[model samples]
Target: MSQKQKILIAIAGPTAIGKTALAIEVARYFNTEIISADSRQFFKEMSIGTAKPNPQELAQAKHHFIDSHSIKDDFSVGNFEKQAIACLGKIFENHDVTVMVGGSGLYVNAVLYGFDELPKASDALRAQLNERLKTEGIELLQEELKNLDPDYYAEVDVYNPQRIIRALEVCLSTGKTFSSFRNKQHKERDFDIILIGLNTDRELLYSRINQRVDLMIKDGLVEEVRALQAYQHLNALKTVGYSEIFRHLNKEWTLSEAIEKLKQNTRNFAKRQITWFKKNEGIIWFEPTETQQIIDFIKEKLITTTK
Candidate 1:
C-alpha cells in the first residue's frame, strides 16, 4: 500500500444525510474499520436519539466508540480525541485507511485539528457555575458570552444553557477567552486525510430530521429520557431531543410543543453543522447519492499514493 491508500476518510455532513450507510459501504469495500465521531452516540443511553447504527451494520464492519459510555460518564471532546487517535492507530496496523463518520463538527475537528490545551475546570469553579446556573439562569451566562466573545456567542448553542455556562465560566474564572484555545496548528497524522462532505436540499434535510425524531419516539426515546431525568442538570443531559422533553415533564411546555421544539432544534443543529463543515477547506462536497463515484475517487487516490 502507498501513502494515498493509507488515507483517513472522514465522512461528515448535516444530520440524516445517510453518512452511516455510506461509511459502512466504503468500509466494507476497503475491508477496513470505522471510528464514529458522533459525540451524542457515545452515551450508551442515547441510542435512538443519536441514530446509532443497527446491529447488522455493526456485524458487517467493525465500529469504534458507538454506545461506548453512559450518560453518567462525563466524556469530553478532549477525551474523545485521545481515544479516537489511539483507536485509529490500532486500525492502521492492518488497513491503510479508517472511516470516521459523523455530523458533530467539534468532535470531528477534535480528531482532525486537535483540541486546545486549556486548564481543566476545578471542582469549585464547576460548583460555582452550577449554582449560578440555578439562580441566575442560562440567559445571564449567554449575555456574558455575548459580551466576552461575540464570535463564539453567535456560533455556540444558546439553547444549551450548560454549554453557555461552561464557556462563560472558563472565561470569567480563568480570565481567558474560551475560543482562544481552538483551531491551533493541525497536528501531523501518519495517514493522509480525505474529507467527504454529504449534502442535500434544506427542506428535504429538515424533513428527514423531523421523521427521525418521530422514529426515535416510537423506539422508546421518552422512556430513556425518563430514566435519565434525575440527572437532567448534567452536561450530558443538556442536549436537543431529551432537553425539550424534560421541559414537557416539568410542565413548562406541552408534550406536543416539546416534540415540535425537539424537531425544530434538531433541524437548526443540522444547519449549524453544515455551516461549520462548509468552512473547512479540506472537505470534498458530494451528494450522498454519489456513493460509487466517491468510492472510485478514493480508489484513484489510493492508486496515486502508490506512485
Candidate 2:
C-alpha cells in the first residue's frame, strides 16, 4: 500500500448493523489496526450493554480505545478527540491506513471534525435556568433565546426547551451568542478520513436492533447492570440497555416490560443515529454484507486521495 498519505477508514452505522465485523475485515485487508469510535465501549465496566466486541473479534485486530477508561472517570468527547488524535499520530508512523469504527456519531464527529472550544457553564446556572423553565413556561424561554441569540433561535427548534436552554446556557454564560459557536472551522489534520456508512432497510435495521437487545438480555445484561447499580446514576450508565434494566431493577416495570421498552428505545435510537449520519453528505453508503465492494471502494478512494 502507498504511504504517500494516511487514511482513516471509518465504518459508521446504526446499532447492530455489523460495523464491528466489517471493520475487522477491512483492518485485516489493509493489515491495519482498528480505533473504536464507540463512546460507550470505552469503559471497561460496560460490556454487554455497549455491545463491545467479543474476545474473538478483539483477537482478530489490534484495536484502540476499547476498555481504555473507567466509568468513574470523566472522559468527555473533547478528551477523546485529543487522545484519539495522539493515538492516530502513533499509528500513522507505521501504517498509512487505520480503521476506525462505531455507531456513536458524535464521538466519530469529534475525531473527524474537531469541535470548537465552547465554555462550560456552572451547574448552579443550569439549575436556575431549568427552574425558570418549570415556572415560566417554554414561551418565556423561547422569548429569552430569541432575544439572546436570534441567529440560533432562527435555526434551533424554538419549541424544544432543551435546545433553547442550551443556546441560552452558552449565551448567558459567555455573554456571546450561541450562533457564534455553531460553525466551527474544520480542524487541520495530517491524515485523511474516508467515511463509509453501513446501510440497511429501515425495517431490517429496526429488526436487527430488537434482536441485538434480545441477545444482550440473554447474555446477562441485567446481571451486568445490577452489579453496577451503585454507579447507575453515572452518565455513562444512562444508555439504552442499561437504563432500561436499571428502571426494571427499581421496580418501575416488569422484566418483560423492560425488555419491550429496551427494544423500542433501541429502535428509536437507531432511527436517530441514521438521521445524524445522513446529515454528512461525505459518507459513502453500503450494505454491511458488501465487504469486498467496500474494500474496493476504499482502495479506489485511497488511490485518488494520494494523487
Best by TM-score: 1
Model 1 per-residue lDDT tens digits across residues 12-119: 998899999999999999999999998888888777767889999889999999989987887888899999989988888888888999988888998887877765
| Position 302, candidate 2: lDDT | 83
The TM-score between candidate 2 and the true structure equals 0.85
Q: Per-residue lDDT of 192-265 in model 2, one digit per residue for the tens? A: 88999998999988888888888999999999999999997676786778878988999999999999988987
lDDT of 2 at 251: 98
Residue pairs in collision within model 2: none
TM-score of 1: 0.91
TM-score list, all predictions: 0.91, 0.85
Which window of ten consecutive residues has the lowest lDDT sum in model 2?
Answer: 154-163
Clashing pairs in 1: none
Leading candidate by lDDT = 2
Tell me the whole-model lDDT of each prediction, alpha carbons only: 0.85, 0.85
- CA RMSD of each candidate after superposition: 2.2, 4.6
